[model samples]
Target: MTQHQAADTVVIGGGQAGLAAGYHLRRLGIDFVVLDAQAAPGGAWQHTWDSLHLFSPAAYSSLPGRLMPPQEGETYPDAAHVVDYLTDYEQRYALPIVRPVRVEAVHRDGTHLRVETGAGNWRARTVISATGTWWRPFLPAVPGRADFKGIQLHTVEYRSPADLAGQRVIVVGGGNSGAQIAADLAYETDLTWATLREPRYLADDIDGRALFDHATARRRALDEGRSDTGGVASLGDIVAVPPVRTARDAGLLKAQPMFTRLTATGVEWPDGTRADADAIVWCTGFRPALSHLAPLGLRGPRGHLLTTGTQAIGEPRLHLLGYGDWTGPASATLIGVGRPARDAARAIAALLGNA
Candidate 1:
């Protein structure tokens, strides 16, 4: 026999998005519950490397009604500080978050949503799938990977420079993580950074300060769908501090074209370059894990849950937060999640006649 729980709304993840959703639902006087797989709050941030820190400043990282601790002039908060802030937020709001509960599957039974989790069965009138985009790390299949004698690890498993000290490392991918890792490793090890795409742009002060004034202006233009100029431009041109450049400058990085093949002793690059590395760290990226909701068929051709222009289809009670839009930046930040949360909460409240 399985235990059963009930709620008006069940939030699937306990990270920033789920917390935001729960916060809005509480304000609307909705009966809700947040189910998180981790033993505590703060989702993926809890599992990040010890030295990890948010590129955004503390000011921009706050959720609804919750603010991070003051560091005086500190632009970015490290991983520990972020976790601490999240823990404090939950306590402050008295949010009802169920932890260490792994949701195995979610399906709609008539008008109600059924969530099967490790704890038991939960039934709710609606479900907010705020599981986030980085649920699983994406590792590409490399030929002869099994035959390689060197240790290969994904970015998710990386902890710090000490883990790779003195080793000749090949760090693949040119994203933020790849760059940061290469920079850190360049101090002690020989590092090589490779990317499929030429390095993308990034803001010099990724803490959001450099573009704060500009982003605000752009936000207004984006909301109105108007053509306006003068804002902090996209981080596409400043590539010096990026991992590739940082590593190269430190005499720890070698520029390699995209990986073409893997051999037992080394890797082959597209330009016929070969390098033998003691280890390879794949900083490729991550994908959303929506396997449990496969029955809903809500996903688009690319496996992303398609929305009706940011509003969930069929289930107006459902809304996806934090999805990136091809034309704008509102889809990928904590601030972006708030709008969708507010919209969904308002819609759900109206539907319930509790507004």
Candidate 2:
């Protein structure tokens, strides 16, 4: 309600995507506020499994203006390293960020946007949502899921492998998290990896850097009205990180086709074979964390809101980021989010007459 409390733009989620938008908005001299739900600065990185590392090298995994400083002798920065970098990036620009502010919803307040939050309300001419999907970790409604008497966890709640020692564990999902967690847990537990389809691997030498480059080049070509050939990589394809490579050598990364259903103690294959498992870690990924925007009635039947170039269709005042390729090509990555964030900020500036 006060002059200082309101801003030309309010950025929700201060993670990579939100920080990138904040950086661009600052450079454009836009009066904006960023609301982060986390108590700290790292966003979802703060909550990842301890040994998690980016598949890309440090040079390729950076924010808008600064390259992520590589840890000495480290090819990829671990999750903690990333958190430190994000924390520093936030301070370097002095972005107007309010922390521990869980936004409940966004409402159309006449000509402006009203952000309802636990901390307080913020009214802005534009609202950019960068809340990535980590919070809404998805567990598929498998048959007998509730009937399974053993422990079941989503990757969002999984922190370390120490707790899984000597137990039979089924790590579900085929993506990077599945590989990485399976790699670590295999050393201490009887681990089985499960994926819907066979997991595709990039060439051992190719990492996130190459994947990002190829993806960007192809995206550029597509934007220029040219058919893109030589598609490099899918964002979902797992990279052969060192641990995963090691796991492969140890025969620990071998994946079984997804089981038809969960049994009381474990999972059952179509052939009537069952594996006894003490725990099942579902790494089945996430949906967009746009529950706060439900008031706008924008979600489609598939649970995704329609968007045209980052702006929500039929709602020009709202922008989305960091969910996945639908929002922007590779928008969920540290390096990939910068482009969309910049574009969103530029558009928001123009909308607010600050451009």
Candidate 3:
């Protein structure tokens, strides 16, 4: 039951990045359509753990043309609130989004890019791929990892502390997810935090506003051809959200260096000390979900497309948005994504002579 559809521009993904690009394209009066793989709105935010919250406040973490409604008396918005906000944003603009259309490939079809999907295919003058990294969770291949008999899952599969109640758990990685999840489970269960190196724990008061300002300044420095300050904290660093702050206050934020290998029952340290655990939660990050664009032969090292302000340098018809600083400074966050999305939209419009 596959059919072929056509659009002046095709935007892949329906998350914050895709929606922002859609807003800009609509403003330009472009005949663009957004293709979302998810059955519903909210994108990857819908898939995060139940207790997860944004490190940024509502005002600072928003897409273009709209603001995320603030959580009641909370410094950070929970994951559900973000989902609701994204859903509302999609409905508010009446953006043209095709649901449940999992794009399988995007390749050359003469001058246009052919977007192959499960439901149908799209022929577009240009394509904007805003698919973020959640779907491709990265787990290092540790020795004896497969032999572990205990439960093991990445943060993507984690939902609640209830699912992991009372188990001796090892939480791995130094990012926000690892810190938050460890903090959540540390009080409920026996948990150990593991990182390759000591984590940079930003002050509990430092939130997304401070990080955004730093990101803006970094971008400004790059623009001015000046050396970066190299002092501002990165978003990747652990921010002390309430739960994490409480855990840190309780002496639970201490982390052990990563174990050398996994044991059938647990993990083994370099000194041969074995830590027994009922399960392991890998808070390791993700790679870009760009399997659809394999046919273009444009993916460079690390499977990332080199872009000049959102437009792919190797493939002129392709643009990547919201993957992170590669596309734009802080482009992965809600507030930081708008600029890259606008630049992507403008580039596509200009290419199609519709600008």
The candidate scoring highest on lDDT is: 3
Better of 1 and 3 by TM-score: 3
1 or 2: which has the higher lDDT? 2
Q: What C-alpha lDDT values do all the predictions have?
A: 0.72, 0.88, 0.89
TM-score of 1: 0.87
- If both were scored by lDDT, which would come out higher, candidate 2 or candidate 3? 3
1-355 per-residue lDDT for model 2 (tens digits): 3432688899999999999999999999989999999999999998888889998888899999988999877888899999999999999989889988999999998888889998778888999999998988888989989989988989988888898888999999888888889898989998999999998877789887787777788778888999865555444478889999998888778899999998888989999999999999999989889999999889975678899878999789999988877788788899889998998988887888842
Report the Cα lDDT for candidate 1.
Answer: 0.72
Worst 10 residues of 1 by lDDT: 323-332
TM-score of each prediction:
0.87, 0.95, 0.97
Q: How close is candidate 2 to the true structure, as a TM-score?
A: 0.95
Error of 1 at 322 (Å): 3.4
Best by TM-score: 3
Ranking by TM-score: 3, 2, 1
- Which ranges in model 1 have alpha carbons more than 4 Å from their true place? 1-3, 203-206, 209-234, 237-254, 323-332
Model 3 regions more than 4 Å off: 1-3, 231-236
Cα lDDT, model 2, residue 192:
93
- Superposition-based RMSD of candidate 2 using all C-alpha atoms, in angstroms: 2.0
